[model samples]
Each structure stands twice: as C-alpha cells, then as structure tokens.
Target: MADPVHKKTEPNGRYLIALSVAALGVVFGDIGTSPLYAVREAFGEHYGLALTEANVLGVLSLIFWSLIVVISLKYLTLVMRADNHGEGGIMALTALVMPSKLRRGHWRYLAVMLGLFGASLLYGDGMITPAISVLSAVEGLEVAAPRLEPFVIPVTVGILLALFLFQSRGTQRVGGLFGPVTLVWFSAIALLGLAQIVRNPYVLTALNPYHAVHFFTANGATGFWVLGSVFLVVTGGEALYADMGHFGRTPIRLTWFFVVLPALLLNYFGQGALLLANPAAVENPFYLMVPGWATYPMIALATAATIIASQAVISGSFSLTRQAMRLGFLPRMTVVQTSSQEIGQVYIPTINWILMFATVGLVLGFRSSSRLAAAYGVGVTTDMVFTTLLFAVVAWSLWKWPRWAVVLLTLGLLGVDLSFWAANIVKVPQGGWFPLVVGAVMLVVMTTWHQGRALLSSVLQKDAFPLERFLETLAASKNPPVRVPGTAVYLTRNADVVPPALLSNLRYNRAVHENVIVVSVETEEIPRVLGSLRAEVRALDLGFTRVVLHYGFMEHPNVPVALYDITELDLDPDDTYFVLGREIVLPEGKLGMPRWREQLFAVLQRNALPATAFFDLPPAQTFEVGHLVRL
Candidate 1:
C-alpha cells in the first residue's frame, strides 16, 4: 500500500509576527524576569562587598557581558543552529551529535549519557525557577510596604499553588495574556530603567568590559565568589535554547535581540544607577528603583511577570518529560494535549504535582528568594556546560567544521561555562546541594530505566524464536486446532523475535485467528516522521502479516490511529483483538542489573501507564499475556 503525503507549509508574515509575540511569554519569561532579583542578589549582604561605585559598575558590567556572550553570541548564534529538524534542546542536540549508525561506540555512549544528565538537570531548574522567581517578585512587597513582610511567604505559597493548579486546565485560554503581560512588563521595566539612567547616565559606562575587570582586580577572591551571585543573571539562558521549537529560530532570535535584550540591559544598568546614587538601596534595589507612588502597581506587574516566567519552566518540564519518555529514557505517564492547535502545549499531571510540591517546599524551607538563589545557579550552569560539550561534538562531527575552528570555538565557550559552573560550585555547601541532589536522583532513575530495558531485551532475545521459524512450526502443527474468525494484533518490541504474547495465546487457547498481525512501534530520532514513511506492511505466507509503525519522538503513539493509516489492513475497533506481553520483573536470580535497580525498574513499570492506555488501544479489545522475567 502507498503511504499518504503531507505537504509542509511555512507560516505567513503575520503568523510569524504573532508567533514571535507569543514566544515572548513562553520562551523569554525566565530570562525576562531575571532583572527582578539578579542585581539585588549580587550586592546582597552575603557577598560582604561594600556597595561602592566601583563594585556597582563591576557587577553591572558582568551582567551586561554575560548576557551578550552567553545568551546572545553563544546560544542565539551558535547553539540554536544545532537544532534537530527545527527542534532545539539537549535531547535534540544529543540526537544530532551522536552518530546514528555507531550506537555502541564509546564516544556515542558517553555523549548519550551526558545529554541525558543535562536534560535531567533541567528538572531541578524547573523547580527552582518557579520558587525563586515568584519569591523574588513577591519580595518586592517587603520594599513596597515593609509592614507586609510578615505575609510574604504565605502570599508566595498561595500564588504558587494557584499556578500549579491552573496547569491542569491548560494554558491555551490565558496563554494569550502571557504575551501582552510580558510585553507590558518589558516596557515598564525599560521605562523605569530609562528614568533612572537619565538621572545618572554614568551608570551606562558599565557597558564597558573594563569595569568588570577592574572590579575583579580590586575585589580579588571576594569578586570571584560574587560570580556565583552574578551567574544568576544568565540562569535562564538554557530555557531560551530549550524552548526554541515553540517559536522557531527566527522569531525567538528576533524577540531576544529586539525586545528582551534591550529591556534587560536597560533594567540592569538602571538598577546600577539606583545603587550608586543610594547605596542603602542595595537592600532591594529592584523594587527601590520605582517611585514610591508606583511601588504597589509595579509589585503587581512584577508578580505577573514572574508567574509567566515560572510557567515557561513548568511547560518546559512537561515538554522535556514527554521527550524523555518517547526516547525510552523514562517511563510512560499520562500526557494531555493542552491545545488542539499546538502540539507543543501539553500537561503531565505527575510532573506538575511533583514540581509544585518541590517548589513550595523550597519557598517554605528557604523562606526567602535570597536563600533560594544559592540553589538556583548550579543546575543551570551544569546544564550549560553539558550543552557546550555536546555542541562541540555536533560542530566537529556533524557540521564538519575544521578541527582548529571547532577546538578554538568549543574551548572558548567551555571556558566561560566552566567559570560559571565553578562559581556555582562554591555555593554547594550553602544551598546549591539542592539541585545536585535532584539531578543525581533523576540521573539514577533515567539510567536505571534505560539499563533495565536493555537487560530485559537481552534476556528476551536469548529465548526468542525467529518469527519465520515460529510461523512454520505453527503452520506444520499436527492439530491446527480451531481457527478464530476475527483479526488478532500482537504488539512486539522486536519484530524479528517471536512474541511471547503470541506464544501464550496459542498455547493456552489452542486456537489461531484467521488473520493475525505482528506490529512493532518504532520511535525515530527526529521531531516528526513524515506520513510517507509512517508504516511498512508485509504479508507472511500464512494468515499473519507484519506491520512496523514509525513515530517521531515528538509524537504520541496512538496504535489505533496508526493502524487506520495502514490501508492494507482493514481494522475494525470492535472485531480486532490486541495481545500485549506483560512482564513481572523479579529482582532475584542473578539478573544483569543490581537487585535495587531491578526493584526500582519494577516499581516504575508497575506505575507506568498501561500499554493499552499509552497506545490508545480500546481496553475491551486489548488482552495481556503475563510472564515472569528475572531481570
């Protein structure tokens, strides 16, 4: 049977503009709101640096150039170009850099491991972004009305709970507001900064890199440690890269250069000017910069902007989890498409609740955004380092850059990444341990799941009979038994091996369906698989036919929907019987995996969304054949 053809269409100019505006809310939210707390944290009491003119200019210079080098030059110009079929992220980059044909090589294995770790670290970022962003914005209340300081934690907790609760309903309804609110936020911050910059225009001199160097030279070790706090300015850089698929390269780049970059630079310099004028304002320079009359209203807008920022990371977590599941690094969970119009908008209840609980806990435990800030940079910096490493591999192997150029470019980026990571490492004893712990736990879960699957496949392969050989045996059986009238579909991971479910059905029922199908679902590395390459169907000598369905990692696997697309097989929902092999993993008997890992895998497997649900199969028509596996 011939496959269907799907023509791709490019977005029109107006549509592209609309997407760019929408991208502002989702893509730039994290980085956009950094101005609220970044400068404040750098000059906070913990740093022990006097709020002198040199110090203020130095910090502002660091913030300026960090944004330029990390977000503008590296991410926008360099990392975003390594997208996999228009999709950008560590996972997508991993797929691009790791040689597809050489799956078992040492370099390929290491690259895949690093990529998974980087993706896992983002989960930590997701939790902290919401906690710190919301807390920092609400902290403005302390400056607005010092009397209301007592209600800060409670208010922050309430807002975060509401945010998480709203996730289930989907962001589509209020998503339209995200762009406008954020746009208002950028404009307001810009105007506020401009007012201050005009008062003390010399603060603009911080734009020079010399100020940053002199601050370090003057402060020495104390300045080096300040980079930990200074690193917070660019913490959202990874989100900008992770969310590239939502708006595409052009719109995201345009939004960053035209809107986000200018607003951020203006705000940072404005804060610096405020600090220089009133050193006492370092207590809360961001909120202090606003006029007394505008304080309450600015607080409201800052809260809205921070919530939008949190939403970006939350949505990012959902997207990352879905990608992990499709790539087989994580177990299946219930995924709801939040928007019929946008495939990227999704909600994972399990992840949402977990994040909410973690975020709220951070708020209550730390009690202030200042403390939470210590926990923030480690995950973001570690993720950046890994991204840089992976990008180097892509630049050399895939992009075919000259050896010298790749080395020079990669080493330069790596130097900046490592410096930031090193700066954050000093914060580990303070609060940075939080993300490291989170990343470690996630790494174990992902690696265990992947390893367990490999071991199970190996065990199954050892006892498996070839499909052709099994068909011959069944056909030549002395007693064919009763032949059922309806069609039977046996889902298998490996098409070359005889499915245990097929064997169990035949052995127990002593009957074979008049028409049978052996179907395998394959996930490709690309963002999407074209309809023309969706499925391959072949007829066997007997009543059996083999079907291999191809789905992109970005797509949800719907067996019923895919089956409908196979014209050669006229499938009826009521008549077809779906046979699935269900394994009960035992952690004993010397399985290749450790006992604890086996148990962990078993637990994850048990809670995993059932095959019927994941594949969107009709429960009434699906039957499971159970077996015990020692892996």
Candidate 2:
C-alpha cells in the first residue's frame, strides 16, 4: 500500500524559507548553543590538554569534521532518508523496523530492544541537556564579573524552575520569538568569531582533516579521551532528524548546512584562534572571545539560547512519551493540547514536573556546567549507535537495498558512533552512569508495560468468544433482554473478542442497546492514517456493529471525533453511552512475567490515565466497567 504520510514535494519557496528560519530555533538550538561550552570543555583542565597552537588546531579540526561528517553527512544526508513516512526519530525508526505484531522471544527482538533502549536514552538526554546548557550559559558570569561566580548555580536553578513552570502555558506565544531570537544569536556569534578569525586567520587552517589526524597521532591516549568532550559539538545532531516531521527535510538540511553549520565552524575556530593567541583565555574561551563590554548582554543571549535548547529537549520528551504510549511501550498519561493552532504542541504535567526536579537537582548536584558535562554525551552517543543500527535495518529489510551496500553504510557510520560511545564509556565512572541508570529504569518500565499488556490480552482472549458467535448465541436465547433506546459503544482492544463491558452489562443490567457498536482502536506503524482509511466498518448480527478505527502512532485516538464521521451509526452526543473496560490487575500469577515485573506493570496500569480522557470520550456519557485479571 502507498504510504499516506511521506510526500515527495518540497514546501514552496516562501514557506521553505520561513520553515528554515523556524528550524533554526527548534532543530538547531542544542547544537547551536554548544558553542557556549564545547570548546571550553574540550580545553578544560579536566582533559589535561595544553593550550598550545597545535592542540588548539587539532581540537578545532575534530570539532569541524564532526559537524561535517556526523551532522552534515550522516544525519542530514543519510539517516534522515530513513524516516518513517514523514516522521523521523529513534522511536519512529524503531516502528519502521518493528514487526506489525511483536511475538515474544522473536529474532527481531534484538532490533526492538536496541530501538527502545535508544528511545529511552533520550529521556536521560532530556534531563541533562537543560542542566548543562543553562548552567553553561549562566556560568558566563565568571567572565563578566568574577564576583558573580558564587551565584551561578542558584541562578541556573532559578531559570530552570521558571522554564518548567512556564511549560503549562504552552509555547505558542514564545515560539515565534524563538526563530528570530535564535537567528540573531547565530548572526551575533558568527560576527564575534569573524572578528577573532580575521585577527588570527591561521586558525582557519584547522579545516583540513590532517590536523584531526595529527592531534590523535601526537596526544595518543589523551587525545582519544578528549573526544568525550569534543563530541559535545555535535551532540544535538540527532535533533535535526527527530524534528524533521515538524519542519520538512529540506528546511532542516537547509538550515543546518547554510546557517547552523557555518556559524558553528566560525565560532569554534574563532575560539581556537583566541586560545592560540591567549592561553589564559582557555578558562572560558567562549565568553572571553566576546568584548568585555558585551559580556552581560552576551550572557543573557546565551541564556536565552540555552533555554530554547532546553525547551526543545523538554518538548521532545513529551512527544516521545506520547509516541511510546500509542505504540504500547508506555502507559497513557494526561496530554494537554497547549495550542489550538498547533496539533504538535502538547504539554504533559507528569513529564514536565519529573524533568523539572531532575534538572534542578542536576544543577545543584553538579554545581558547575563542567561537572555536568562529564555526565552528558553517553546517552546521546549510545542513542546514536542505536539509530545507526536501526537505519541499517531500514536500508536492508525495508528499502531492499543490497546487503553489501547496507554493510558498508552501517560500518562507516557505526565506526564514528562506536568510537564516540567508547570515549564516553570512560565517563561512566565520572557520573556518566546517570543517563545509563535512567535509561535502564525507563527500559524496565517500558518493557514491563508492553509485556504485561501482551499477557493481559492473552488472558482476556481466553475468556472472549468471536463476536459473530456471541451474537448468534444471544439471538438463540429463549428470552432476549429488552433493547434499550440509546446507542452503546463498547471500546475493546480486539474486535474479534467480546467486550468485557458488554458481558458485565448483560450479566447485571441484562439489557442490550438497540444499536450496539464495538469499537477497537488500532495504532498503525506509519505516522498518520488518511481519512479514507481511518475506519473499517462491518455490520454484524443482532444489532451489533464492529468498528475498527485506525490511527498512526503519532496521532491521538479520539473515539468520539472518529465515530462521528461514520454517518451510518448516527452517534448521538447526549444519548450515546461510551462503555470502557477498566482492568484491575492482580499480579499474583504463576504464569507470564516475573512477580516483581508484574507488580510494576500493575502499578503502571493502575496509574494510567482513564480511557475517557485518553480517547477523548465525553466524560458525562462515558462509563467504565471493572474486571479483575491475573498477570
């Protein structure tokens, strides 16, 4: 079947330019803000690298090529092409490679685990990005006035607090400003670097790959270790692909290559020039490169940019949460539509508060951006590795590319990802374990939720009979219950199985609605389902109608809105009853997952948002019947 989401056409010229500018903020914020600290951290005292011209050149060379190869070549040119329909992200890519229905202990399980673990790692990234980015920006105070150094951490925590609090208000108001502000930021930083580069034009020579090679040849083990810090330059490269759905591929690539990449190169090389000219400036190369008078203004600008970066990551976490929930990897949570104008702008209070506390704690615990930097990179690098592996699967299995071609592409990209990952692994002892631990915990939660649901389906299936058989049996009954006037919609997971709510209602109230509808929502692998293919309707016997509503993983399942369009059912808002089943999980089962996992699953199930809210059912007319089931 032809996919509905992926379109070959590009946006019009005017829209393209606008999107590219918008992409500057959402897509490039994290990587764009890296200039505040990437160079400073690379040459920090922690790496033990000297402030010599050759070392400066070498680091610049590595940073430049990393942006070129990883971001420009790998992500934009290749990985972005592996997008699931028009959507791209580790989770979307995972959905692309995943089987329509996952079977327990399947061979493709390895890919599923890799993709999920990668997606899980982003949560860690979400937590750390805000802490490090904001702290790094605020730390510029030390350069402006040495006296203000003591207040940096407190200021950072305060800023993060305000940012999280503002999430409830949504981004529609501030979102327009992000692009223009970020554009100004990029232009200002570019000019700053240009001024420095003109003074020491030789730093531009680091553009040659030989300097990167020579740095490794000279520093040996220490140079290799320095990559952990250098990797920071391209840390947000994945955002380009992840946000591709919001902005098209052309706009993201256009923004990256034309705007973001040049600005980054100039700034990084300019920082290298500053370091070469004045070794003492290594303490804070990014801010030191700024004019003494512009220091405070620059600090504010950097802070704004970092805040934008943090916003993108936080928003991404919310988006990933929604996708995970739709894909059955997560339990449903309350998702607030933050903007009436934008469907993508959603706010999840649960996610926002959790991230807020974690980010604030990180700022307090680390006390400095440099320390927080040590805890970063591992999760992102590992996620990159998983993305590459999943991309390989897409190339080979989905796209039907030759095995040899896939192998070459995978090997080349994996080399860069694995090397960075190995460099980052050394940081595990120095607080890098934070993201790993977070990813592990998340993986446990996600896998447990998925497995538990599977088991629940199995048990429910055992008790359910075919819809046709149930209808025929009811019709054959000696005395059928009196038909009710209102239309009844019973929501269930399987259309073939009898709805538990229907069973409970019949066993107790002993009455069937005159018009009965069994509705099952199916989340498709693609990002969206077109209106033409949204619903599949089948008329059954004895006043029974089976309706299956199809939604993409990226979409929210709104039962009432979808059912309203059917026309034939003539669903009424006032008279219709939306019957839902509430499963009360009993974790004391000998079969299925371990007892501990079952307990966790039970807790997750119990806390999940009600179907009435998640499916957009009218609460006034919605009612849930409870059923107990062993895991």
Candidate 3:
C-alpha cells in the first residue's frame, strides 16, 4: 500500500489536485449523497413533528452543526491524528491503542475490544448503506411521476444487482470516473439547493445556533428524539477517517471543507427551504426540490453517486477483513489483489458475495429507504463512539498529551457521540436491531477466533520439542536419516522450537533435507514493516537456519519473496520446499472455551484459507502436515 507520508508532504501540484479529486470520490461519496434521504427522514412521519418555519430552521441548524462538529472537527481533526503509521480506521486505531504487551484486565484490552466491535459494526453499516442510498435515489421516480413508484423497488434491486456483480471485475477501470462524476454530483446538488434557497432566503437563519437551541426548548423530548433523524447527515463520518490512509489527511480534509461540506450544507438548507415554502414536499424534498425538467436526470445522477458510495463501503469492508485476518482477529480467507499497481485494491469473494446478498435482502425486505434508515444509525453511531474512545487512548497514552486536555477532548466528543447513540437506541425495535444482531454475530466470531488462536499457540508451544534436544539426539544417532538434496522451509508459530511438521516429516520419510530453514511469520501493529527490518535470520550449528518474517497488520506475507530478499541466505525459490502445520481442532476437551464456541472455532479453523495460497507459496512445492489437537 502507498504510504500516507508522501500524500501529506506532496507540494501543491497536479498530484495533490488529483488526490483531492479522488478523495472527493471515494472519501465523500457516502456523505455526499445523504441529501437524497436525510432531510426527508428528518421530517419523516415516525418523528411526528408537524412542519413549521421554526422546525425547518432548527433541523437545518442541527444538520449544519452536525457536519461541522462531527465530520469536520472530530474525524478530520482529532481521530485522524491517531493514525497508526499513516493508516486510519477502527482496525488501525485499535492497533495503535493496543500495547506490545497486554496484561490481564488491562485498560487497553477494553479499548481493543471496543475497536473490534466498532470494526464489526462497519459490516452492518456496509450492508445497509448500499440498500438505503440506492433506494433513496431510485425513489426519486415517485416525484418525477407518481405512476413510476411501482418500478422504484425493482429498479433499485436491479442497480444493486449490477453493482455487486461488478465487484468481481474490480474498481480500477471505473475508479477514474468516480471523482469527476461525484464532482458533478456535488455541483448539481449545490445548484438544486441554491435554487430553493433563493426563493426562501429566510431559511438561511438556520445557520445560527440559536435556532437549534430554541428548537429543543420549544419541542422538548420531540426535539431531542429528532436528533436520531438529524444524525443521518453524519452517518458517513467514519468513512472519512477509515479512508485517510488512501489519500492522507490533507486531501480528505481539503475535500471535506472545500467540496463536500459546502455542497451538503447548501443542499440540506435547500431542502429545508423547500419545506418552508411547501410542506407537501416533505415526502421527498430532495427530488421535489429538483426542477421539474431535471427530475429524471437528477435521478440518474443520484443513482450513480449512490452506487459509488456503495462501492466505497464494499471496498472498505474488504480492506477491514484483510486487516482482521492479518492481525489474527479473524480466520484466514482468500484475498485477491484486484490491481497489481495498487496494493490497497483487493477483492474478497466470500465477503463480496455475503455483502451483496445481505444488501439485496435489505432492499427487498424494507422496500424503501425510510424504513432502512431506521436500521442505519445504530452501527455508525456506535462506531463513532468507539473511534472517540480509541482516540482518547492515543492522545493520553501514546501521544503523551496533558491529562486535562485528553479528558476535555474525550468528554466533548463523547458527549456528541453518546447523544446520537441515545437518540438512535430507541430505534432498535423499529428496524435498528438488524445491525445490532449483525454486530453481535461478528463480535462473537472475532473473539472466538482470536481466543482459539491464542489457545492453539499455547498448546503448540507447550508440546514443542526442545531445539537443543532435537539437535543433540540427531547428532548422537547411530543410523541417522539420509540427508536430502533440496532445501526445506518449515513454517511454525514460534521460531525458537522445532516445528511439528519437521518431526512429522522425519517420522514419515526417515530423511532430512540438506538445508533446513524454520520460518515464523509475525504481524506487527504498524501499517507496513520496513524492508530492512522485515527478516531476521539466525544460523544453527548444522545446515539449519531460523528465520522470522515480520509483517504489519495491513500487509500480506509472502515468505518466498522475503526469503529471496535476504542476500546473505541466498535462498533459491525453485529449490525450496515449504512445509506447514495444519491444525485439526477438536472440541472434546473441557478446559478451554464453551463447547459451542469450541465447535465454532473448529469449523472456522477447518475452512480457513490454506497457507500455500495465503503466503503466495507454490502449491507443488508446498506440503501441509496435519496435526489434531483437542481443546
């Protein structure tokens, strides 16, 4: 993956402009399209608030300040600063907060759990985002011609079907147009809002905080509950931070402030302005605000923008899954590098299909964006709260900020996040349970996999034969095994001990390779390991050498490539045979996790991606030695 350092330091030029434009496409797409449904949802019948001049101004104020406070101030400014080696996202933030050494009941452990849960919540968001965005965009047909409403659901499903099917082909070819098309999206929405705002200039007063304050005082609980609807505007806030690694903080922040932020505000205010003049537009203000002649064109453009948004979220999910696998929070899964030129561009077929089915199901089930909106905020708001908590740890523990500053900053951010969370919590009975259920399932899977790996590692280390004892026994043997000609590489969890695969090979074949290399792969907390520090090699008394390959949580491990890079070893790729230990987990024991969880772990272990594929090892040269272990 390209480092963010260059993205940050690149002087003002074409490269920077290009990056900013790209950021506008990938980073801002979700929030950019919020105009389609956010205002309508605010005035939705579920809230039960009658449309009035004051209510319109108040809702617009909340929308404006939410964007400024949450998106601009918190994510762009605070959470992004906690990037782990120029990478941002819940996974990266979790890596930053997690210490090299974690003790039982340590405070940082809680932070790690929260971060994992947050990352899990993103999967829930991923499923719902595409459903809602597309539904909302397609619903514009109802405004253009009420008779076309019957085709809205079918059309939305068709567009989503095409979008998900397109995932296998990757985003490289069409990614270039994402920026220019999104640029037009922002411009079009801005113009749409400007036209309405011109007619009802009085709506401009919503920019004042007074309107928001008075709305709460006047409406009391209703105003407070309405925050749930207003939160729709900032649901994409996490995307800004998650994608900071791609274009760096500079480009994202520039795009938000200069492009996305203004366009959103203008469009949101325009919706509010339209509501003030004609409350009848409340059903679909975004489309109704569109000029009659441009209704169909706007629908087409909006659909394009929504698909782009869906693509960004889908890509983010793939990236997050890879990060989890590398960090051992999840089981190994097939990850396909979709583009040779871009390391970050990956496609996980399992995840792609899972997301597609879940998204299409949601659209078919909910049948409208408004109902889907009920299920949307819980995950995103919870994610935001987790990001804030993780950021606090980085500020105080890692960055060594003053205690008072960290406390104040955390409280201020949490105040807003918690408020939104509270508003959305009441919605769980009304479609919000979907993401919660999904998050809970994911959390269980992640925790079970993580714990299972730890237990398996402990067992392997405990049963491992001592390296000294093995060597001494080998030297003393009267009839030693015949030495083979080719080099053998045994992959193990711990490099200090004899690999079980080697022992199994020795027992089965009664022979040893002429040159033996024991390799262990370790994942670090940072984004990328420096090339110079990637490999650590130690030679033994015999023709045996111990090797440890270090990789970052954001990287893929390629053993052959790393070994070949160590000029001292002069390892030959063609001559080397890779040996891996394959574990067959059994749930017959009583000492570990619950029986159900143990069974779950066993299933996951059985289905994990093979080492030959994951490590880029040649299948013909790679061999797996299966070992059964009871938990």
Candidate 4:
C-alpha cells in the first residue's frame, strides 16, 4: 500500500496565536488549577512542616525548576520531537520506538508493556483529576462562605456529574469560551500572586536553587517527603504532550513560554510570599491571596478554571481509549464522533460513565482535595518515568541521536522523574494505591486481550488455507453450486490468508458472489491517514478482489464509508453483504493462553462491540459466521 499523501500546511502567525490561546484551556487546565491545593497540601498538618522561610522558598524553588526542566525542556524539547505523525502521548511515543519492525525483540516487548502500563496509568489519572480538581475548586467556598462548608462535597459531585453528562453533547459550543476563561484565570492568578510578592520581595529569593538545597539539608526526610505534595504543580504536564496533536507543538510551546510558565511561576512565588508575611494564612493561602471583597468572585472563577481542567482530562481519556482500541490494546467500545469538523472530538460512553462514577466516589471518599492529592502523583509520576524511558528509546533508535547524548539527556530527566516517583511512592499507603490498583486492572485487561488475540491469530494461521490455493480451487471446481449477483465483503485481519467467513460460506452455501471483496482494516501507527491512501483495491482471480482499508490509531474505522470512497470499485451500498467471523473460544481445548486468561479474554470478547456496530456496517445485510476456536 502507498503511504498517505500529506499536505503540510504551516499555520500563519495570527492562526498560530489563536491556537496558542486555545491550547491554554485544554493543555494547561490541570496544571493551571494546581495552585489551588498543591502548596496547601505540602504544608498541611500531615507533613508536619512549619511555614518557615526555608521551607516555603524551597518548595517554590522546586516547583519553578520542575516546570522548567520537566515540562519545558523534557516534554517540549525532547518528547514532543518524537511524535508519531504529529501525534504526542505515551502510546504515540511507544509506537514510534517499538514499530512493527522492532516488535519481535524481547527488549521491545518490555518497552511495549511499559508503554501500555503508562497509558493505563493515564486512565487512573483521568479519574482522579476531575475528582480532585473539582473538589479543590469547590473547597474554595469554605473560605468565601464558611456557611457553605457542609455543601462542598455535594456541590463538587453535582458539578462533576453535570460535566460528564455534558460530554455526550460535545464541547464545541463551550470550547470557544475555554480559551477566554482560561486566559482570565491565568491573568487573575498572576495578578493575585504579584500583589503578594510586592508585600514580601524577599520571597523572590526562592528563584535561586540554594534555598531548595538548604531546605532538604535542614529538614532531612521530612523535606524529601514533601516532594510528594510539591509534585502536584506539574501534574498537568502530561496533558501538554497528550494534547499536542490537538493544538500542535509551536502553539503549545509559545503558550507555555509566554503564558502558562510565567503565570504558574508567579502564582507559586506569590503563594510563598503570602506565607512569609502571615503564617496563619497557610490554612487557605490560595483564597486568602484574594482581596477581602473579591473572595467570592475568585471562588467562582477558580471553580470555572477547575471545571475546564476536568473537561480537558476527561476529553483526553476519550482520545486515549480510542487510540488503545485501534491499537488492539483494548476491546472495541462505542465511539461517537461528537463533531463534524473536528475528527479528534470523540466520546466513549463506557469511559465517560466509568470516570463519572470514579470521580464521584473519590469526592465522597477522600472528602478533600488535599486527601486526594496523596492518590494523584503516583500515577502521574509513573507515567512521566515511562514517557522518559520511551523518549530515550525513540531518540536513540528512531532519531539516531548519539548514544552519549541520549544517555546524558535521559539520565538528567530520569533523575528528576525517579525522585518524584520515590516521593510519591511513600504515599501509596496513604491513598496513592488507588491509581496503582486502577492501573493494574487496566494493564491486565489490555495485556490479556492482546495476548488472547495473538494466540487466536497463531492458531488460525496454523490451520489456515493459502488464499492462492483457495482461489485456484474455487475457480477449478467441477461443480460450482451457484453465482450470486451482489457483493460479499469478508472482513479479515490478514490479507494473505483466507478468512473463516469465506470458507464457511463456501462450505455451507456452496456458492460465490459475483463481486467478492476480501476486506482488511489496518490501523497505522500515526494519527491519521489521508483520503487518497485510505483504501487500496487489487483485482484478484475470478470475481474476487482484495480491499485494504487503512486508518490511523487515532482514527475511527468506518469500513462501509471507506469502501464508498473507492470510485473504481463502483460498489453499491444497497447490494453489499458484510461477512464477519465470530470466534467462539473453547478454553477447554489446546490453547496457549492460561485458563484464567482465556476465560477473561472470552468475557472481554463477548462484551466487545459487534463488528456491525464497530465498523458501521449495515446490520440488515451483515452476516456473522460463527467458528469454534481452541484459544
């Protein structure tokens, strides 16, 4: 098959600025809302730290440098460059590193597993982000209206429920407001922080690394543990890379440098300055930073910002799930394209409801964002470490960067990531286990499905008849039963082998269609395939034709729609009959997979969306040819 013809169109200056503005709302939301609870959680009573000059300055310094090194340098400079056809994320990076050519090696298998684990962790992050962000934002009401304290959880739950419900309707309508709302948010937080900094100019000293160094030296283990809470400042960093394809690298980079980075730094420093002037304000420093009259307004704006952040994470979850499904790491789920123009705007019903319930449960269980913070960083940190590992591999293998350069760069980033992970690891017992458990469950599901499919494919190949032989036999048959007028489309994973559906039809019906199309839907490693290269049709002997439909991992496959795009085939939609092979796994039979895994795979396969629904095939004309498989 020919490679997709891509027309690279560079965004003009004005359009680039527009995308940068838009990137702020989607890409920076989670990190943007970190100021609400990050610093407060670090100094909470659980950590047993006094609000002294050294501690405050040290924490601020850590936040500043983490943003600079982790988000700015590591992701933007290194990881973003390793995008798979302008798509970024842990999975995309993994695809780049462990392409099909490198899949057979044991080391590459390990790399793939790590990437899947990282992607699974992101799902956990998705659940926790909305819960914590919304809860923290609503907690602001406790300061603005102490009478509203009892209603915090209820309000957070309500807001979250509404958010998830609105997902089905799509974000296109309200998406326009995201940029403006986030712009106001960043501006407001920056100004609030600036006001506090003016009162305590000495807090500016935190910009120096000396205070952070002295902090660890003075506090010992306690300071190291504080790194867990401080790590929250960069929790949204992954979203920056994940959403890169939505907004592109240049805009995200520009927004980070000009807007997000500066705003976040100013706010962290301002919080430090506030703590210095009045230690008592530590209880709710983010809200207290606002003027007495502006408290209520700030609470409302903070809520809006957090909601936006939650929306971003939820949307990302949908996109990630779609990618996983296409990559065969997950079973097919109901994927609804929410927008006509934006191919990336998608909604997965299963993911949405799962997140909704998980987020609500977290709010009710943890009660406060500070408590939830313990559960947050472990998954985020683990994901970052995996990304760094994948990035190092891509740099060395794909980019062909010098071994020494890759080692030096990876080590520097890995050191920071490991430190953060080590700090968060201590919180596992203190509620951090939630995400790990979620990630573990997802890992099992993904790996089981992948292994099960592999085993099934291997078993099928063992008994498979060569397509050429099958075609020759069909053509030379002494007594051909009948000839059908309409087309028969048999879905297959392998083009070189005969599909079971075809063999089954031939055996039972003893007939052949005038137009037989052996259809194979292939998912490429990139984000999208161009229309020109979407389908490849080759004439075969007799009335048979081989049709291959290609889609990117980020795209949804509609086989019928793709078939319609083939002008030469002159396929009539009304006269087409789609044939799908349904495998009935007999776990009792000789299969390579473990008994438990085979059972799990069976359940998963049973629950998976039908090919008629998944491929958007017309149900009335679709036929499922069942086959019993020992896998």
- Where does candidate 1 stray beyond 4 Å? 1-12, 100-104
Model 1 Cα lDDT, one tens digit per residue, 32-112: 888888888898788899889999999999999999999999999999988887788998888776554433588878888
Residue 291, model 3: Cα distance from true site in angstroms: 1.2
Ranking by lDDT: 2, 3, 4, 1
lDDT of 2 by residue, 325-362 (tens): 99999999999999998878999999999999999998
Clashes of 3: 0
CA-lDDT, candidates in order: 0.88, 0.90, 0.89, 0.89
lDDT measured at residue 280 in model 4 versus the true structure, 0 to 100:
93
lDDT score, candidate 2, position 116: 93
Model 4, 95-169: lDDT tens digits are 776673443598788888999999999999999999998888889888887899999999999999999999999
* Evaluation by lDDT, superior candidate among 1 and 4: 4
Residue 238 C-alpha lDDT in model 2: 81
Q: Candidate 3 at residue 78, lDDT? A: 77
| Alpha-carbon RMSD to native, per candidate | 1.9, 1.6, 2.1, 1.4
**TM-score of every candidate:** 0.97, 0.98, 0.97, 0.98
Error of 2 at 580 (Å): 1.2
Which stretches of candidate 3 lie above 4 Å from their native place? 1-11, 100-105
